[model samples]
Target: MSPFPFLSLLNWAKTQGRHSLPWRAYFHLSIKDLGYHIWLSEILLQQTQVERVIGYYDHILEHFPTIESLANASYEEFFPYYQGLGYYSRARNMLETAKIVTEEYGGIFPNNADELIKLPGVGPYTAAAIRAFVYDEPLLSFDTNLEKIFSRYYHGNRFRKLTQKEKTLLEKDFRDTGISGREMNAAFMDFGSMVSLNIKPSDDNKWKKNTKDYPLSDCLWLKTHGTLEIREKKKKTVFPTKDASIIVVLHENHRIYYSSTEGEYQSFLLPPTENDIRHAIQDFFRSKFNLELSVRPIHDKYFENDRPFVVCNAQVQKGDTLFAKYRKENGFFVENT
Candidate 1:
């Protein structure tokens, strides 16, 4: 959303960013492989770590090769492939979603967000990711990195942050439709994850502060202390926050998977689970340490395979519509909200 074509810069650097993981090769393949790979990768990511996902990714790719093969696969047969991935639900969802794709969508993943979100595991981030990389649907994806970007951009602009009406301007920056939105959102996220600095050595550091790019780093303050302190060293720089308070936030789409880093913004395909929150407790050590944890936007698979997802907020309920997510508005990622 910068006046500049930041996406081009990040995409050019995608091969070298913090997200420059080996598993992303799955993205370069055909859409069929891309979707399947993304699905398999997300399932695995939800339950396991990145390094472990690499081999598991290859194994899943080798065995299933396509959605149909996976749809036809049984959980008894599929569970072993995810042995290292501790999250059982992720695997179950993979199988269920694959089957759903086979039975409902004719064995091909739907290129649209509505149909994609209907899949067992596909949430806002995952569905948008599928649309971006495979279908080129242009839906914007929000993740850890993006949350930082938006939070920084909207640092003091709480009018936009607190309600839906003000956030719509953000859509002009990364609307959900086409490759441009994907690139903008992806780049925004990557910028935060990679380029942004993680000054916090541990999550327990309650005081962290970071500079944002809204109006060229005009925003540099702590959620705890407010913007009264801190020096403006430069624009778009991530610093340390050992005792500062206030973290970044990202927009959560209605019906999209959501779980943010306390005051920071991050999105997930599946809603974050209690177990996931239990595990995330450890990450807090670092969050508190960050003077400003660098939340750069670089599009790479942060949530894939079997990592846990965001804890579902008040937004989701039975018979929820895709658009329903838009209405619930956590005042987080629903940029429109």
Candidate 2:
């Protein structure tokens, strides 16, 4: 794939009598607003309408004011900022992610893609966007909007299915445009919006408005080719996307849970009602595993109702047997062991 000529596209837009919008003002009021801009825009733009994000963007700036402030803010503080934004989880995730960035990463915007993605609610696209904007990482943020622009530019078909190969090739092509990383980010988004607004999609138009080389619903060469391949594998229903991976959590109760279903390990709130806690316990232990699991709370009392669990390095007496310790205070027995 040839370079996307992103700088040329920018020049084309400029010569056509459009000047680059001040990305800073649109995104940030000041450097203090940088983190606010990134975090706010990332959440607001996720699966949300652009028209709706505009006002909420301003509202968030009015509230948090700074990245450090956002980091220090409680979930309650951030939740109010998310009133009109449908996803309540984004606000909470951002609050948590911001704190981790502040506490662990020393308040510097993370440049590592893996580290950024590990933050709450961050994914490939969001992580790439943050790295590009903050560190000029030259990474492409491939989202549905950018995908559409590529579909119009190359597919010629009414509907284009973007294969993983195409996405990889497109990123490679756009990177060579030598445009600023931010421009590459903005151009495809603007181009996609412009294509929809200025030109109507139809077969009668003869691909004039669209620049696709492929015949509609026909095989043709594409600019980018993704290396992703499909393989047959067993599929099962799970709370979120189902993969082979599994997470197990042993609660303080005698119950066990597969962590995949729970939102997060710490997301589980304590101080639940007896019924709620019991229900959670029941749910975990209810799973298909045959081996027994139990939580043995560490205790100080010798005659405690719990069996005597060996803690630290304590040698059992000569007469001590598994049977005797099993009934001792301060321990709980597990059938698995």
Candidate 3:
């Protein structure tokens, strides 16, 4: 009944939606079940590929099993279960949130935006997702995929956040269609994943050939726009690059000194002045391990995050008091004999 073609979208979803996904079974689940299953999956699926999350999802469920179980464990206890999933901070946040949900809220995830967003690692988009999926709230979870779909299909290829008035009107229109918010959101997810791919026009030659049979292709606003100039121009964000440095200290004992500080051993910010690099490294070693180091800059490496790191090799100049101190602190030798 909505002007936004919900019937067509629902029909498309029935045929093309990822119906068999494990987390899609939230229809009759209680809040606890939804929290355990859907919330965990959504968190894992953040910036992670669906394929990559599937095994971890099952593994997490096998270990935690419930919100209460997850809550009972500290981050240290939960680390092994969540190890391979690179973002240790997310795991920590998940543990903190689980504990809050279990101990404070009696294991019931908050259904409203205000309460939901207050949870650790739960932002506005995540809160929207939980509200729509768990509480059947009439709202859209505007992630990159949905943003692409809505921008092309409705906003004339202009990608921008919808105004509050716009969202309310759209929600009202969507509610009139009698489709539950969960199903509608799922359809958008499928349509975005299947049809509104992020392929650029120049790069779409192969995609065009592959997706020629897709029914959703007919509804793509890009088809009506014709020229690439009219399509949404992706905005690229330029991040200011910073230089960092790390020193790998090797001892004659064949053991390497390591520190968990900065989440990497011997990592520190590269000083702006070339002369300061050695002194900075020395200061860090003195302060952290109470050891003086003979430092030599090795080679620079750039990480995926676009930050450059100057790798350095260091030899222990002094630290006779080190063996006693290092044993009590986080910094340790990798293979201490």
Candidate 4:
């Protein structure tokens, strides 16, 4: 609709994009190393902010620098570095994928979309990202950031998913520009993140003050409609309230053991219920951590994630070596003396 706006966005991204991010440097890395780094970054960035992911990404690479190291380590071995990152399943999928790559493909990632998609936890978006970033294939990563940029640029702030016909037309426009896939996709992603922001800047913001024309001035949407349109806010999904019981088991040594929820933020959870809350909590510990504890509810308080839960504390009533060993070794057991 607006001739893709490729050149303008690319030029903007060049001076202002996120260049310091560790994963963006592909020049010094071999193809195998490049794939591993990009894959890890993409998975960690899923539903997570860039600021939050940087530390974890570095910590993970520090421990497991190669695919072989990651594949050789157990989830428990990797969990400490990955803990508090939330989305435990992403780590699990990453571990599975690492093993697959190590054992099946000799520690090298597949270059094509078809083969890359077959790996664990890899979907179209991730596959596309790997191809574009690592292999420099001429493909769009097509995540929400780019979606927002395109929606506003094409539809004038009527933020909606682009249709296939629109994407095809844009791709054709992109190809006509003869930009490299690496440069174009990187520019689009950075523009969406840094420039095409969700919150509109204040009128006197430096960006507007410095330039005679506001950003995207040449785009058809902005040219035809002088100002951004305000779309009615979509209602947030209301999850059904669920009651949960959380146990904090403390050892005489001042260390505590806790159970973590999977998939969602290590945050609030709507965990499935069993016959009763006590049994559910007990069953979870027994099945998952191999620890049997006599849980007695001490108080009712909302846990860190803001879910209403029964806070129960268990003394070292039983000894589970698996927990004890890891707690000591990985500092899983935490509390000051």
Q: What's the true lDDT of residue 57 in model 3?
A: 91
lDDT of 4 by residue, 1-337 (tens): 6586778777777887888999998899999999899999988988888899999999999999998999999866997888666545577788999999999888888888898899978988999898888888878888777777677777766356789889888878877778778888888777666655433434446434443443566543444342465555899865322445444543333333432432211211226464655556556667776765454444445555765455544432334633332133364333222
Candidates, ranked, TM-score: 4, 3, 2, 1
Best-matching candidate per lDDT: 4
Q: TM-scores for all candidates?
A: 0.53, 0.55, 0.66, 0.68
Worst 10 residues of 3 by lDDT: 321-330
* Residue-level lDDT tens digits of model 2 in 56-130: 777777877666788888755676566645445566677887788778877666678888789888898988887
lDDT of 4 at 325: 21
Q: What is the C-alpha lDDT of each candidate?
A: 0.50, 0.51, 0.68, 0.69
Residues 1-337, candidate 3: write the lDDT tens digits: 1256666788878887899888898767788789668789889988888888988998888988889999899765787777666544577789989999888889988888899899998988888888888888878787777766655555545354556676676667877777878888989887777766544455568556645654544444557442332545699764322345443544332244544352334433444334566667777778987876656545444554655555655555456533311121354434333
Worst 10 residues of 4 by lDDT: 261-270
Q: Listing every candidate in turn, what is its Cα RMSD in Å to the true structure after a full C-alpha superposition?
A: 16.3, 14.8, 10.6, 11.1
Ranking by lDDT, best first? 4, 3, 2, 1
Better-scoring candidate (lDDT), 3 or 4: 4
List the candidate 4 regions with Cα displacement exceeding 4 Å. Answer: 199-215, 220-228, 233-337
Residues 1-337, model 1: lDDT tens digits: 2332344545545554545544456446776666776666666765356668888888887888888999898866886676645544566678889888778877667888787887887787877777665565545565544545455444532122323433454554445322364445445544554555434323334333342322223333233233432345676633222212222221222244333333333543322323433223324424443221112222232223434222222222112222212223445444223
2 or 4, which is superior by lDDT?
Answer: 4
